[model samples]
Structure formats: structure tokens, C-alpha cells
Target: MELRHIRYFLAVAREGNFTRAAARIGIGQPPLSQQIRDLENEIGTALFHRVPHGAELTEAGMAFLEVVAQFPDLAERAIRAAQRAGRGEVGSIRVGFTASAAFSPSVPRVFRDFRRSYPGVEMTLEEANSAQLVAGLRDERLDAVFLRQDTIAGDGIRLHVISSEPMVLVLPSGHPAAQREKVALSELRDEALILTPRAVGPTHYDKVVTACRDAGFEPQMGQIAPQLGSVINFVAAELGFSLVPKPMTQLQAKGVAYREIEGEVPIAQLSLAYRSNDISIALRNFVSRTLVAHRQPRIDE
Candidate 1:
């Protein structure tokens, strides 16, 4: 039997008459009676006793009514849950990001805002390299990701650029260059440098190398770190200095001093990446609201 049958049966049981029940349900008496009959037949039991003046519940009807009494509340809860799900307020979002992105306040601010707005939607954050984040997005293992814009490329992935800022050099606090407010790229030629994994994002790594090369000499690469946090930590420990996006400097690393890189090398761009074909209304709304809320500031400004 269909849902209407259960509803008609419940209505008739409550009203104790087919005519009034049908009226309440906006259906005619005959159709309501037929639905009740269908419901009884489907259940292989008679649910009512016919009387001259009105309908009365049978033993089976009494048990059925007790169970069906809960239906109205159950149906209401189910409908509300479905609506919340459709609104993207009651599901889980798997978000991936690089170590540097985690250190940035904007990323955490977005997450806090999202949680406050959709408390029912659980967030699972994964920290990885840009390459791994991109792969997770591509493999459908991640719902979305925050990473450098240069790391995201491919037809199916959509990128919404959130911010771009000038690159800064992180040096040991005791380093001589730390005294300068802005360090020229040429000055780093002979300095030991900490670099991110070249395989993580060849374009970004190349940009760093190329920027140094353009300054008239090749960089003396010292330590290679898999993640930006490690690179910054290494710099704090005086292992080597590294070039990082400005936002990363916000991270409190003892003994690490930040200086602006004085040159025309491209600034780091942060973006939200997700599947272009994603049809989740909640995800779309989250992305749109986040972009509107976190518009990038001009690097010079």
C-alpha cells in the first residue's frame, strides 16, 4: 500500500468516521474508504469494526493505531532532516589543505564561520602537501581544499581564488639579513635555503628557483621539507632560510624572522578548489559565501 493508505487509515482511525476523515485529508469518503481497505489488505488484517453509527477499532486496529500514532512525529522529523540535508546544513565536509594554509588565519576563520552557521555539518580537515590535496580533490576523497592557486589545475576542478600576497623570506633571528626590513633576492645567492618538495608543486618550486636565478646566481639548497610548517620550523632552528607567502609569517615560530622579498616574483595566491560538477547546494553556498567574505586584499595595499 502507498503512503496515502497509511495516512487515510490513520486519519479514519483518529476521526472515527470515513466522511470526516476524508474531509480532513482533502479527499472524498469513497477514496478514503478504498485506501483504508487497501491498507488492511496489504497488512492481511482488518483494522476496524463497522458499526451502524460509526467505525470502531478492532484488536488489530488498536495495536496498529498505537504504532501509527508515532508516524506523524516521525514523518515530521524525517521531512525536517531531508530539508536540512538539502540545505547542506547536516552533512560532513571533507576539507584538505597544506600545512601553510592551516597556519593562515583566513582558513581557520572560514572554518569557524562555517561551523557557526552550519553547526550540524561536521568538518574533517586533512593536512597534506598541495599535490596531495589536489589528488584528494580529484579522486573524490575530498569534498574541497584550500591551497595555493598554482597547485590546482585540471578540467573538472574549479578554483576560486581567495587571496594573494607578497612572498616573505624567513631567516634565523640571528642572521644578518634579519636586520633589514626588506631583503633583496640577490643577497640570498650564497645563503643556505630550505625548499619545499619539488614534486609537490613544480610551478611554485620553479618560481622560487627561477626568482633566485634571475637575481644572478643559483640558490644553495640546504634542507628540503615536505610541508611549510616543517620548513618554517627548520628556519627557526637556524637550519636554513626559506621564502614563504606572507600569511605564513603570522605563525609564531621562535627565532624565525620574516623579511619582505624585494622583487617582481609572483606573489602566492590562495584559492578554494572543488569539483566543478559538484551539485551540493550546501557546498556551493559555502564556497560562494566564503569567497564573498574573504576577498583578497591588494598586495601593495
Candidate 2:
């Protein structure tokens, strides 16, 4: 009826003598014998044939013993699995990211470290804009995400800043300003600028606009792109110029050239965002170690 009953029955059946079985199980002979009697009564079948010296199994007893013999192995395996899960070595995690994050080394490096450390855990990656990633975190659809700090607003999430890099002006390689090491924001005042879609993250779009305004003039807004990769592609084709995170230089765009912006505005911050309630040990270690290993060194311009 219970695990103990199964264990007791197996022990008595194996030893074939009530006194010996009780001794092996570290219990008194009378109690062990009474327990066997109770078990038989519950099953409505006699499990042993009484004899003067010892006992022999009934047909039903032999059948039950064969099935119960497999229990020890099954129980051991179940306990091992539970232990691994508790230690965060075996589980599934869903991660979301912006398109630009893929271009950076932080995401890939962290994932590689996580896989090596916890080979039993499975990771799923989803690509979305910062706004969508934030929504996914709130709805419990994503375990964590790498996104721009400006876009994060809600208080229910915790953020760990991984790196910060200055915004670069991306221009066509053949453009006149491309030859320069740095470009002033005022130089692009009259030039058409490709803008990231407002739906991508309102806060991020506003920051860009504010930066341009602080430069003494409003930008000539051109076409809006859905994601960073597309915006970079457009810049490569000389469709328009755009300001992007400096790490984006890692992504080689054939006709695109990047330059540091000449101003005192704060650089973009990249952070790992997750729900405050999430307590995944694997996720915590992955985020922390990856940032430490591949973080960008500070550069003074």
C-alpha cells in the first residue's frame, strides 16, 4: 500500500524467515510478522506458506515479488533526476533578444558557456525587438532577454548592465563624412536619417530624438525600419545615415562606415533583463559569467 509496505514485503520474501527478515530490516520479529499479516489481509491473499522452521512463497507472492524487484532501480533514477533539476543542471530556458544583440559577442558567448556548464539543460532563443522582449518577460513567455537599457521601463523586471558603448554614426563608405574619424551631430542636421520604428521601443526612439535635438537642430527623419539589421542594411546601400551602437561595427556591412559622435551624451547601455521573480540558478550564472568574460573595455574618445 505504501513504499514501506513494499520494502517490508520484499525483505520478508527474500529472507524466507520472519526472524531473519526482521533482523535484516532492523525491526523486532513479532512486529515484522504482524506487518506481513496485515499486508496479506489488505491484499486479500496469503503471501507465504507457514512452516515449523521457515516460509515458502505463495503463487501470488512470487508474482508480486517480480514486479516489486524493479522498484529500487526506478526510485533511484527518479531521485537522481530530481536532484539534477534542483541544482539547475537539467531544465529548459527560453531567451529573447533584439536583432542587434546577435551581432554582439555577449549573447553568443554567454550561451556557449551555459551549454558547456549545464549540458543537460536545453536553451531556446527567440529574436524580437526590445518592446516585444519586455512584454514576453512580463507574460512569462521568456526567461530572460538582452536589450537596450533605454527601452526598459517597468519596475517588475530586474536588469543587469552587461556593457555600454558609444553611439556611432553609420554612413555609406563613399559618403564625404565616412573619411572622418568622428562626425558632429550638427553635420547630419539636414541629412535624411533612418529611424528605428517607434513600436520597437518608444523610450529608445525618444532618446535618439532628444540626442539630435540637444545637438542644436531636429533631424530630417526618413524611412523607419523594423529592426537593427534592416536599418544597417539600408545604411550600407547609402539609402540614409543612422546612429547605432558602437558594438554594431562587429557586423561587417560592405558599404557602411562608422564614426564616433562628437558630444557628451551618455552612450547606449546594453543589459540583461529578466523578471524579478525568476530564480533560475543557471540563468543567473550564465548572465554574470558571460558579462565578465566578454565585456568591452572602456574606451576614451
Candidate 1 displacement at residue 41 in angstroms: 5.9
Per-residue lDDT, model 1, residue 57, is 92
Candidate 2: C-alpha lDDT: 0.80
| Residue-by-residue lDDT tens digits, candidate 1, 1-301 | 5556668888888889888888999988888788788888889999999787768999999998887877777888999999999888887888898877776688899888998999998889898888888899888999889887655555999887787767888899999989999889888778888988788866567777877888888889999887778888999888888888888887878898999877765577777889988887667767866786786432223
Candidate lDDT (C-alpha), each: 0.82, 0.80
Worst 10 residues of 1 by lDDT: 292-301
Considering every candidate listed, which one attains the maximal TM-score? 1
What TM-score against the true fold does each predicted structure earn?
0.84, 0.84
| Winning model by lDDT | 1
**For residues 96-178, what per-residue lDDT tens digits would candidate 2 score against the true structure?**
98877776776788888888988998899999999899999999999889888644675888777777777888888998888
- Residue 233, model 2: lDDT of 88
Clashing pairs in 1: none
